[model samples]
Target: MAARRKAPAARARRRSAALAVGLGVAPAAVVVLLAACLPSTPPQAAEPAGPPLPPVSSRWAVAPPPAVAVAGANPSRAAAVDLVDGAWADEVAAATGIPRRAVIAYAAADLTVAHEQPSCDIAWNTLAGIGWVESRHGSYGGATLTKRGLVAPRILGPRLTGDGVAAIEDTDGGALDGDDQWDRAVGPLQFIPETWHRWGADGDADGVRDPNNIDDAALAAARYLCRSGPLGTERAWRDAVFTYNPLTRYINDVATRANEYAQRVELG
Candidate 1:
């Protein structure tokens, strides 16, 4: 029998070319064929895709502590009134002096309204707190002489006073129109003309939501709180307090006062 003929080197080149074409890199066939003609190394393994990373948290500031519950007291009773009263006296003697009965009454009214409109719940305590801070239970008025000198008081009129100018200076550090009497903050609630225009309501049913009247002011505060929605959660409540005033200390103070009041009411 004739000896089997050896496969031609050209046949090997063709096979390599076919392999390269199958791999979508026909040009690489020439290199592979040349390597096969010479010495060759083992093929390397392909790398797999890596998994994706987890997302980062976006919060910047640390969240405040959860509001403390009143000691030995239920949150929904006469204890709440004492909690508010004693706390107000201890925490904010300068700006607020709300009676326990008033706060309890307001809270009850707010709860009743909340059944009809859930959004009002969060605002009830917050609004009351703000009112206490702003007017000291509606004891303050516009325009008075201070130790510093004659201070412009917030007067209800078409004109602003020197005291009004001073009041503006005190609150805004001379940024407002201190020269104009129209810049006065009105009523027991201290409603500036612009704020009154936007938020004023018929709170006492005497046909006006006057910020100067305690009843009207209280109602307006309740309405504002319901609108703000702070009562939903601790963060939201803190944010709502900050929105009322941009100061962190103010927020802390308000929360502290509220907690104190709640606790006092519980004890009483």
Candidate 2:
């Protein structure tokens, strides 16, 4: 067999994957999983309902306590309206013409999990900025995030075969993206199987931790970015975003997009 190739800095962290350099997407938003990171200690196997997330600490500078997990999406469960007092999700949706549930869930997840990543202060727009660049809020190629947050027809990245892209062998046995020859980035957030395996989150409480779901993907991205350090500052944010795709251009693009989203939120 030929020698195992290494992915660029964009894929794996050289443990070793070069990871998601480009997914044939637009210039600024190069949505992709940075290869995959190894999972912390496996979480406890137990069913959880719509329980409140744990408190984040102000001390952690690297990775959550290896115990931070997100609840999966549940169609039956209503999204929290705590962003604003007495504003129903539908009310917000009708007023803003935005996906109310999606906005709230992303915001809630960001605020909730930031506890685990005390240093990381990711905003919902930061994620929306990523989503916009990645799949146009799950509208890429006519794909959409359903009421339950599943991106239909599934968004996948090009195969990492070392031909101008990183050469990642079939790691998950074609489980996540189903390529069989190599792993592909799946879902609106475009998480690679290896990375998802280590950091996949269940944002909806629906039992299965599906990355194709925006809620899950957003939360997983949050945890991954925060796992390193705080994102409240420019330097810190760049470093965190760089972990997703270790390219200076990619990080800069994400920063620009994220700032745009933040401004829109403030103005809107």
Candidate 3:
């Protein structure tokens, strides 16, 4: 497996530029500092939906039938969102101000991970926080997240040219990110081609693992987070989020947004 690319200071700058371009569609504005630092411990908090999610013995125990049954064009072969309750998604999305489609993708990813790796116990809101922070749930630059979970006119981060950023030469040869000279973080989750090559998932069971798809990206992010350890504990949660981006301010921002989403659900 390829080593994960270290997120560079350029990402902070790229995020600010992307967010600024899509201010109207962005849920919240984020101010990022261009400084690298170790991850700090975040506050202890309850999981988004209450207790830790129950674990499953294996994927076969919970994997749904491979039927394209979402009542729309380009339905997924196995969305796995049948595990999530529709009413609950509607309520939580409305309360937390997250897009309903994005909410479903996050919650579905959490539940799928629960089935695949029960010990991780990642939360949906945490994924939401990441989505909001990274491309505003695929709405960056006014990109449209269609009903099929595909982000049109896909989002791409700045080139990794070592010009105040990680000096990663092009790995995909312009295949995934359309840049042969240099690699750009692709899709809503802003995963570089090399990292995505190792961790990308077929979230919607569309037979194609695409970073441009919300369902795929959310699940991939969850799997990546679980690599740190179970997130039921505060230390573990902090560690997992830090692995995504090893910066104190980044971890704190994600924690704050995640906690806010959880709190909103409780208040409602």
Candidate 4:
């Protein structure tokens, strides 16, 4: 991206005309005055942004999460389904201090449910990867998830109005994003209002469905990925991620970060 500025030439021209009209100055003199006022040559243009860098390795991404974090839910269930790598989440959290609650969510999303879709193998790290990209495990913008897994000061993305983002019209009647004119991606996982309405889930097995909840969003994301067929092969992974968001950079970032989280957590 380049920083754009208003050219001084236009302003100079306006001043030149006023000066020429106010005083009976010669046209040549006015021209000379304007020339003196304006730049000899155009200002140097701002440099364009560089091309998107390829993933450092298909297995890992390089960015670190934001340093500050809002307090999150306790996530200590009295009767919870055990994750395949249940202890791994606690291990990573103890090792890295990234919040055991979030680590548990990732592990559960990865291993707990088949999500009613047998073909897909949604990795916990992949969910963690998307979390890293989306809302930093619901700790974005100095906000945090409530103990119920609901995003407290719910995250809302910039309006998608076909400007540079998608051209999705409002689907929910301002129920989720409070925007009836246009659609906004809501919550840490960033689901557009309409999509959330259709796919809103209750991963915590709670009675109500809320897109703002990390458990619900994660399970919903898993369901979405599973809809794209099997995720066992690389092609399957690409297809599933493409279905989620159709940008090469997005998919690559997700894949890279997911793998990195996977590697780190799997250490235990």
lDDT tens per residue, model 1, 12-118: 00000000000111121111111112223222243232111100111101221112223343323432223322343233222234543344324433433343354
**Candidate 4 residue 115 C-alpha distance from true site, Å:** 6.4
In candidate 4, what are the lDDT values of residues 155-227, reduced to their tens digit? 7776657665555677687888899987777776777666677677777776777777777777677666665
How many steric overlaps does candidate 2 have?
24
- Kindly report the root-mean-square deviation of model 1 from the true structure over all alpha carbons: 33.0
Q: What is the full ranking by lDDT, best candidate first?
A: 3, 2, 4, 1
The residue-level lDDT of candidate 3 at 50 comes to 29
Can you give the TM-score per candidate against the true fold? 0.46, 0.68, 0.72, 0.66
Clash totals in order: 23, 24, 0, 0
Which of candidates 1 and 3 is the stronger one according to lDDT?
Answer: 3
How would you encode candidate 2's per-residue C-alpha lDDT over 1-268 as one tens digit per residue?
1112211111100000112333434443333334344233222343222111111222223322211112332222443213312243344334334466456555545544544554456655566556655666667788866878888888888777766555667879898989888777787767778888988887766678898887778778777777765555555565565566655555555555555433333233
Candidate 3 ranges beyond 4 A from true positions? 1-78
What lDDT would candidate 3 get against the real structure? 0.60
**Residue 83 displacement in candidate 2 (angstroms):** 7.7
User: Looking at candidate 4, what is the lDDT of residue 119?
Assistant: 41
